[model samples]
Target: MSDLLRRVATPCIGVCSTGIGDDVCRGCKRFCHEVIHWNSYSQEQKRIIDERLDQFLVQVMQDKLHIINAELLAWQLGVQRVRYPAQKDPYIWLFQLLRAGAGQITEPRKYGFVVDSVWRDSSLMELREAIDREFYLLSQAHYERYIGRYMQKEG
Candidate 1:
């Protein structure tokens, strides 16, 4: 029995959140009753628990992949408009990227007043152009046009 116990062992990540009263792990969804009786359980029981855990992790990873793919599709559509545009303003699609940047900022003042005003405007295309212009100017590496100390030299 001892040899079997040693051979039928499983791995634990030690983030035990098995609910005290619920009889199930709040963190990993493993049953608390199974956990409490882990030593007494058969090898087959442990295998079933492990399989269930693997399935749960796979679902979590798949959901993340779906979200990432959706964002990429939206970006690709926006890019295609820029590359082969029949309209006067091919670059108008870039406003979505700028609006996205505004949302990602942790601090409000980092991007400057022009960006802030664009975010406030009703026209999404105009807002996108404003952001693109800002990006182009900044990419030139000039500090004069920039609001603050733009890209300081590393020590």
Candidate 2:
């Protein structure tokens, strides 16, 4: 999703909590400053932000699911019109698929992924919520460890 300048786009989902002074946006889990400066950031900065989010997703997802067919996963996301960054790891697109259309997905295999047997009892929507919760917590912790220290020192 290219923004005005055709650079790397924001991850904003429009449910931003940053305006209310949250250290992290509940929607995309971006630090408030990251959200505020996203459009002004160089492509490299944007890529770093994206990779951080992707790494967090990888942490939370772990072996809970696996992408069996990268092309099929990409195709499914395209077919669903899920907004995801282009040229990223297929797992990023997998997260986008779950975020946008988890409820509509009943069978993981058909979507070119496999839910671990231990997680099979949970629905995709449930897994999506779990992932979102964990991701947000990780982002909040990161802020408190890094950015929050500087903020506290200034104030």
Candidate 3:
């Protein structure tokens, strides 16, 4: 397959909220400009964005949980029909695994994850809430770092 054909797909989850003044898409956490210009970006540009997102997610997951059986976790996510991109980012898989196992992941370690005290001491809903909060915070920081500069030029 050609490079374009083999490129990883956009991470859009269909819940686009960027058009409503949100700096980041709640679904995919991409900056508004990134979403708007995604189709116009070159493969290298797209890869850069993907890598940045992966880095953020990896930071969150590593700080909050430890995966012991990564293979089994991936299999579990697959069995549950969680739709994750084909990229090799473990954090993406971890996100899907948490979403799929929500409420039912009482013993995360069995699935190869060791929940950090930040999450271990909280209920499932609380954990999910914390993750969402942290994710959005990271997204906002990213938007400020990248897009804020352009905004200053326009003012």
State which candidate has the highest TM-score: 2
Highest lDDT against the true fold, candidate:
2
Error of 2 at 35 (Å): 1.5
lDDT of 2 by residue, 46-114 (tens): 978878988988888765788898888878878888877666677788988897889999888888999
* Clash list (residue pairs), candidate 3: 68-112, 69-112
| lDDT tens digits, residue span 17-120, model 1 | 55445334434345555667778877877766655544444343232212223334345545544232122121222232343453443432322222233244
Error of 1 at 24 (Å): 2.3
TM-score of each: 0.33, 0.86, 0.85
Which regions in candidate 1 have their CA more than 4 angstroms from the true location? 1-11, 66-155
Show where candidate 2 strays beyond 4 Å. 1-6
lDDT of the structure predicted as candidate 2: 0.85
lDDT of 3 by residue, 6-108 (tens): 6857988788999898888888889988999999998888978887877887787778877777787777677778776545666678777676667777767
Q: Candidate 2: count the clashes.
A: 0
